[model samples]
Structures are given as structure tokens and as C-alpha cells.
Target: MAGNSWILHRNSSVNFEKIGDSAHTMLIADASEPYEVFGSTTNWRDPELARNTGPQSFGNCFPGETFVLLADGRVIQVPLVENERWKLLRGREELRPDPLATQRPDTPWELGDRPYVPRPRQQSGNRNR
Candidate 1:
């Protein structure tokens, strides 16, 4: 993941500002190497393009779910879901998929077809800070 990036839901018609408490956010640690973002807002025009790339785990991700990509390769999903959490994995350890989640296709976005993109920072004043 790119250092401090934002991602939008692929199928979402509504923007982040309109969404409320229903959003579940999470912080995923990048215990290892950095991940290349596929659909950053500045680079990608269509959010759905990412649905073809990346890990299958992201394929089932919902569109309303906003992902915050960290510089350390960590990822954060907003609005935590019930009984669901992102655990920090150790070296060489693999993440097993949840059978329950696999069965549900309600994820708002798909990140399996394209690479994840880094959301460009908003321009504040004239400094871009």
C-alpha cells in the first residue's frame, strides 16, 4: 500500500462524506513488504477497475467500505464489523479466509482485477498541505 492513501468503493454511488456509522474501519499491519496500490483516486478513474486485481480477499470487500492504505503497507477499513477483525500476522504466516465472509457477496468493492490505487491528498489552501 502507498504511504497514507485513501480508496473508494467500486460500486458505490455515494461519496465518503455522505456515509455515516455503517462504515467499518480497520488497521492492517504490513508485517512484511509494501503492497502496490491499484486504484488510487488520482491514478484510477473507475473504482471498479480494481475489482480484477489484487488478492481474492479484497474481491468480497463491500463498496461502502473505505480503505486507508498506510505507508508501512498497513490497511485500515472503516466501521468495524461484528465478530470480524483484521489481525496482525507474523512473518511467513498466511491469512485464512473466513467461510462466513466467503459466502457473503455484499462487499461494495472488488479489488481482485486491478491494482489498488492511492487516493491523492486534498489540496488545502495554496500549499497542498
Candidate 2:
């Protein structure tokens, strides 16, 4: 739940996976006492539950933003809204419009809306004789 988090939504349920590891990650139903892990698919379509749980319950570790990898292999950085629910929302819903879209540092420049701007090349100290 710290650095570099990954999430998966399948069969009407959401789960979190650790980046760079093949281990099975459990979905904690309640992070409090009893510490129950979701054993089966959850009823994620319930709007009331989603609104009450908030975004953090949906694997958003960062306070301001969270990076999500879509099923189509596309990665998107979503800006978090305080106390907002994202459990029932699709990945595309969190995406900002073209003009406001932000490209993550790890994302390739070519995939972003902004045109690639390369740094100027430095001239060699030794000039051609």
C-alpha cells in the first residue's frame, strides 16, 4: 500500500496487486480489527457502499494521486478527490481531458498529449580540425 501500487477490477470486484511480484495479494475488507480479507467477489455495484467507502478503500495509497494500469495495458495517472468514491468507477472516468491530462514521469512521452520536446544536444569540447 506504499510505493508503486497496482489494481485489478474483474468480475464486478476489485483487487490490488503488488508491483514487481507474483505473490497473490489479498483484498482487505476491513483494515481494522478482525482484519477480514474478501474471500469472494464483492457486490461492488452498490452505489451507497461505494460512496461511503471512499477512494482509499479502492487501493488508492497516495493522498493526491494514484496510478492505475488498465486491462488494455494502458497506464493512467488519476488525481484523487478528497472523500470521493472510485470503487464503482471505470479507469477512463478518472482520466482528465486532453488539455488537462498529465503525463506521469515514468510514462513514455510519445503516449502523452503533449508533443515531445527533446533537450538540445551539447557540442563536443573537441572541435573538428
Candidate 3:
């Protein structure tokens, strides 16, 4: 697992305003905080891309990738979801763009043909705070 995670703050240095003007707001998100997407907007984007990339994203993770929140808080990536803790990272009671879809665990937990393998979760307190 990559001990260094990139945690994205709500107000980061990313050119989100510019990015938003182009592709439907490329969201920088926190794995631990589902509500915190980058670009100062709700998750609004090309459903096809989101769903397609979903296979590789912790937000849209498959059955076996560990999702970790970056300590910097700018970004998150799939690690080794093989462990049991990754399931906790999965969306549960988090708010949703589509309540119908988010409500179903079966919908999100479905295995993808090409799965993502994020770095393993960092050991607690392994980094210099």
C-alpha cells in the first residue's frame, strides 16, 4: 500500500474552475468523505465516463481494490481491496446523486471485467502529520 495518500481539501490549488468550464467538472474526491467532490459542485458528469471509469475508481470500485483517502486530501486511488476494511470505504449511507442506484449494494458491488488494484491501506499513523 502507498503510505502517502493525496487528500483533497474543499479549497485546493487545483484549477477546478477552469476544469469545470471544460469537461463536466472532473471531481477530486475523498474516499473517506463521499460528499466532498472537487470543483465546488455536486457530482455532475458524463454518466458513460463515470460508469466506464467506475471500474477503476474507489467511488465506483469493484470487489477487490482497497480505497484510501490521501493524507494530503487532494485525491484518492484504489489500493488493495482484498482486505475486509475496503468494504467500509464503500458508499453506505452517504448522500447520492441517484438514490435509487446508491440504495442497492448489489448494484455497486458487482464485479467488473477489468478491476482496479489500489495500493494497500496505509498503516495507521505511518506518515508525518
Candidate 4:
């Protein structure tokens, strides 16, 4: 398989609507062929955004959980091991994660972690005054 692991949008499975902002994404794997993924997110949805920044790559999916698709195509959750690594390949080329970059926290969300807070924008003064 070209992809040792594949990403699936958890939200997509629940509903086909595109998450204009963000979606709950997850990484999944199988021992043999790449799961024949299907859905609006896979087909009708934006491809570039999907491939570049959205739910189509690595650890960005669900952060700390791994999943496996069964032969019947049902998805089941799995735990992500800190040292387990996967590779993505295109034809004869392969993309692998840097060994040094593989460290991750055991839990996806640390206790007491603060949620993101965007900084307020500053307004510019009228120079013509």
C-alpha cells in the first residue's frame, strides 16, 4: 500500500458537510491495500486544501489516536504508540517522518491546557486628522 496509514475525517463519517473551519480528523491504517475511501470530502470536497492543510495527512488527524479499517470497511479506533511511525508513498517515492520529530504526549489533551485565545486587533489612527 502506498500509504501505511490514512486519514479519515470523523465528522465526515457522521455527515458529509464540509467543515468550513475545522473537522475532527483521524489517522487510520490497514495491513494490506489502502481502504477504498469514498465520500464528498474525498471526491467533491476541495482537494488542494484537503491535501495541503486539512484531513489528509499525518498526526494532524485526531492528534493522539490511530484507527484501523476492517475488511468490511468499518472503522475501529486504536491507540497511538509514541514510537510507531508510518510512511506515505507516491509511485516510487516515499515520504517519511523525521525520526527526531516523532515525540508526542501520551494524551492528546493535557490537563489544564488552556484553549486558544486570539489576540485582539489594533485599529489604525486616521493620518488625515
For each of the candidates, give the backbone clash count.
Answer: 34, 0, 18, 0
For model 1, how does the per-residue alpha-carbon lDDT over 1-129 read when each residue is reduced to its tens digit?
A: 221111222232433333222223222212111123344331211211232134322212233343544323455553323113322211111122223322323333447896444343222233334
Stretches of candidate 4 exceeding 4 Å from the true structure: 1-55, 58-61, 82-129
lDDT of 2 by residue, 5-117 (tens): 12322322222322222221212222111111234122122112321134223333233554544443455554556224334233322221232121124432342567444
Off by over 4 Å in 3: 1-40, 44-56, 59-67, 70-78, 91-129
Of 1 and 3, the candidate ranking higher by TM-score: 3
lDDT winner among the candidates? 2
Candidate 3 lDDT by residue in tens digits, 2-84 = 11111122222333342232221223322321222233222222111222133223333232333344223434444453334
lDDT score at residue 102, model 3, on the 0-100 scale: 24
In candidate 2, clashing pairs total 0
The best-first sequence of candidates by lDDT reads: 2, 3, 1, 4
- How many residue pairs in model 4 have overlapping backbones? 0
What is each predicted model's overall lDDT from 0 to 1?
A: 0.28, 0.29, 0.28, 0.28
The candidate with the higher TM-score, 2 or 4, is 2
Better of 1 and 2 by lDDT: 2
